[model samples]
Target: MKRVFIEHIESYLPDERICNEQVEQRIRAGGFDIQAGLLEKMIGSEIRYYARNDEQVSDMAVSAAQKLLHHYPDRKIDLLIFAAASGDLIEPATVNIVQQKLGLTCPGFDLKNACNSVTNAIEIASALLLNNSYKNILIVSGEKTSDSIKYTNIEKETIKDHFAAYSFGDAGVALLLTTTTEDKGLFYQRHQTFGEHWNLCRIEGGGSMFPNDASKLVFSGDTFGLKNVIYEIAPPFVKDCIQEAGLTVNDIDLICTHQVSKDTYRMVAETLSYDVNKIMQTFHLYGNTAATSVPIAYQQSLLDGRLQKGNIVMLLGMAAGINISVQLMKV
Candidate 1:
């Protein structure tokens, strides 16, 4: 089988930067009484990026994809897979918009698995490469939570839940998965789904299941409803994925888990007895960028000199449908 490697990766944040202190102040002004370290403890984030009101998820994804293409201008991309939850519009698929904007002629489509979209895209792209169907595949994942965020009546839920209303930042990320004799490439990947938990963390009004009406958006107290589904199903999914990779928790050099919350991260780390330091967190700063979290963190790790070549890295993500996916890669 041919090897699938990440040729390049890039991420884009809104021009606005929201620091932890600012978030604390915002929540406190709203009478939430959240401490400064509270968010740090919950999501291991110091600051997060947010998109502007006019910016759409597709805009961010396109910007990041353009950056990646600029960096590696010589490569010929044959396929583009856009994995995202909060796209620009309801119809026409975000990938179509991205394809039009970037002028990318390669075959492209959108993949939706909630937060696990990117992970699923990676698995599919790898299979395509191995089958000689495509040589280079560009995967873009992003989320603009701020666009749909509702800042009122947040006190109805626990701090963890309410914090997400404010804490979840926005970001876009792009990755180039190619079939080459590159030294760094994916080793294995696994995906699983539990559709029973689909309605747990979802936007009840937007999709075909619940068609968004004026009342759904206007009367709805919360936009992305609840985090209970994620809290319930993610831990076991993480463990299963790790175990299926044929490696113990300790074998992972660095875990690039999805950016949900500090509680979620700690629970997974403790369950596997893995060191907290082994996990790279961006939620505190970037909140949950849905499909973009892991890839964004992976890019940051490379920029910061933390993720070096030859290291064994694991990309894990859990999204709606209570879906779970893990991709083990040798960098």
Candidate 2:
């Protein structure tokens, strides 16, 4: 079998930077008393990137992919896979726009399994590499959650959800996966799904099932948005993925779980008996960037010099429909 390794990773965040203190102020102004330490320790976010309304999800993805290409100009790319939930437009796959924007001429498409899109795309890319179908695959994950945030509904009792409103930021990430002879590539990957939990997290508007109509112009209290569903199912799914990877919590040198929140990270880490020190978190600094979380975390690790050759790294992802995917790679 051919080994598939991430050759390069890059991330692009919006220009606006919103820190935790600012979020606290915003919350306090609305009659909430969330502590600073709680935001730091629980949400694990110091700041998050925010994009302007004009900046679409595909735009960020293109920008990140361009950065990757700039770094490795000579590298030949054979495939591209864009993964995201908050796309620029609903009908045309985001990858189509990305392909045109990036000037990439290859077999490319979009993958959507909620936040797990990137992880599942990696699994598929690895299989393609093993079969000698593609030499290099570019995986781009981007999310613009700011577009969907309903800030009008903010109150003390619903502050946690409001925290979700502020907690999620926009960002894009691109990774290059290439085939190699060394074992330092993709070692193992497992995909699992619990479709019964599909409705747990979703955007009810602008889709065929629930078309955006005049009556649906305004969101309601029970709209079933991001906050209500993600918090309910993420923790357990993280544990299940880690366990299925066939390694103890300690076996992974670095854990790059989804960038949901600090509390969710701690809860999942505690459940798996993994030390907090072993995890790489970008959510606090970058917010919950949906499909882009893992790749952004990967790039941040590279920047921090935490990821070295021969290190054992695990990529854990959980999406709506309660989909869970875990991939083990030797750096």
Candidate 3:
């Protein structure tokens, strides 16, 4: 099996910035009794971006891809994978639209695993590259969660449970994975799903189970869009993933946990007895970008000099499928 190396990576954040101060004011103006500094203390996101109303999910994805494509003008994309919970349409795969926008002739498709979509694509791309099926694979994700936000109906008591929903913002990320002769790319990857907890967090109205229609329509907060209930179930998976990769918490140089919230990842680190400083965070600045969070953080680490070549990095992603996935990579 050939190794897969990430040749290039980039992210696209819309110019629209929404600061915590604005969100707090809006929530307060909505006639809800809220304590001061509670939101930032809860999620730790001071600012995040939202795509323009005219921008579709594919548009953000194409913008992100162009950055990497511009960097490597001659690189040919053999496979294009669009991984995100937010898609442009329900019929045709969103990847087709992205492929058309980029003028790529490669075969393309979509992979949906809630927030774990990108990591899942990486695992699949690695296998394809190892089997000599494709030389290079491009994974693109555009998450426009702002479209689903429900701002009208709110009860003061239940709103606290839905605070995580407000933490989500819009962003896109692109990753180019090419075949490498060296054996130092992905060392270990593991994914576990708890179907019983699937109802903990989800968009109930968009799929076949609920159907997208006016009569059955539901708002993001009304459904379980951002409600998290896997706090106790997640720690065991994190420990197992490290052990499965033949590594311990101390062996990892950088750990990029999903940018869900400051409290969420902080609890994860404390639960695993891992060093809090080892975790690279973007939730404080960009909020939760869904599938793009890990890649966005990974790219930021590269720019900030926290992640480097040959560094052992661990990526932890948990999503609405009640899914927990971890990837141990040698960058």
Candidate 4:
């Protein structure tokens, strides 16, 4: 079987830089009194970007994909997959919009499972590449989480159910995967979803459940409840991923874990007893960018010299559907 490897990865941030204080001010502007510095103090995130009013998720995806194509001009994409926790529209799938915007003629579609969308895309793309279905696969995600922020109805007593939205930061990420001759690629990939906890974090609208309920469109979540479930399942799975790969935590060169807040990010480091330095830190700068967090970590790790060719890299994802996925690969 042919192996799949990530050829290149890139991330794009929106132009507007919004900090914690600004988030609070926006909420206050909506006729709600909110305190400054509380968001940063609670979430441990200082800054995040917001896409312009005119910019759609497709536009941001195109920006990241264009940068990727610019760096590798000779490559041809055989498949395009747009994975996102949030997308441009309600119907006709977002991937079509992305493909048309990028002027790509290849087959395209979307795969969504909250923040695990990109990770799921990678799993499907890997299978396609290994089975000789596609030579080059481009997986992209653009999350305009600012669109889901509930600036009003933020009751202080029930804040846990709505607090994750405050950390909503917009970002775009693109990843390229292709068949490689090298034996090093995916070693072990595992995924599990606890449907029982689906309500722990979710948006109540945009589906058959509430097709026309415009008021239910904003994000609703129980960050503490979600984190508690992660604390129970995620750590053990990380250990299992390492063991299944015939390695130990010390053997992995880099572990890129998706984190929503500073506290959840630290839990990974603390639970696994792994070096905090080995994991990429993006929460402080980008917050939880939905599905883009892991790929953003991948690109940043490469830029910071923590990742190199032939290194064992692990991608750990924790998403809202209470989904958790771990992929061990060599790059």
TM-score of each: 0.86, 0.85, 0.92, 0.97
lDDT per model vs. reference = 0.76, 0.75, 0.82, 0.87
Compared with the true structure, what per-residue lDDT tens digits does model 2 show for residues 169-275?
A: 78888989888888687887887777876654556678676685533322233214544455455556655655766667677888887766666567557767788
lDDT of 3 at 207: 71
Using lDDT as the measure, what is the rank order of every candidate, best first?
4, 3, 1, 2
Model 3 clashing-pair count: 1
Question: Candidate 2: how many backbone clashes?
Answer: 3
Model 2: lowest-lDDT 10 consecutive positions: 214-223
Separately for all candidates shown, the number of backbone clashes (residues 3 or more apart, or on different chains) is: 8, 3, 1, 1
- lDDT for 19 (candidate 4): 88
RMSD of 1: 3.5
Mark the regions of model 3 whose C-alpha exceeds 4 Å error after superposition. 28-36, 212-229
Task: Please report, as a residue range, the 10-residue window in candidate 4 with the lowest summed lDDT.
Answer: 152-161
Cα lDDT tens digits for candidate 3, 120-203: 999999889888899989999999987765454567767754566778789999999987667567878888888876665656
Error of 3 at 73 (Å): 1.2
RMSD values, in order shown: 3.5, 3.8, 2.5, 1.3
Candidate 2 segments whose C-alpha is farther than 4 A from its true place: 20-45, 153-163, 214-246
Report the C-alpha lDDT of model 4 over 53-144, residue by residue, as the tens digit.
99999998889999999988877899999999878887788999999999899999999988999999999999998888999999999999
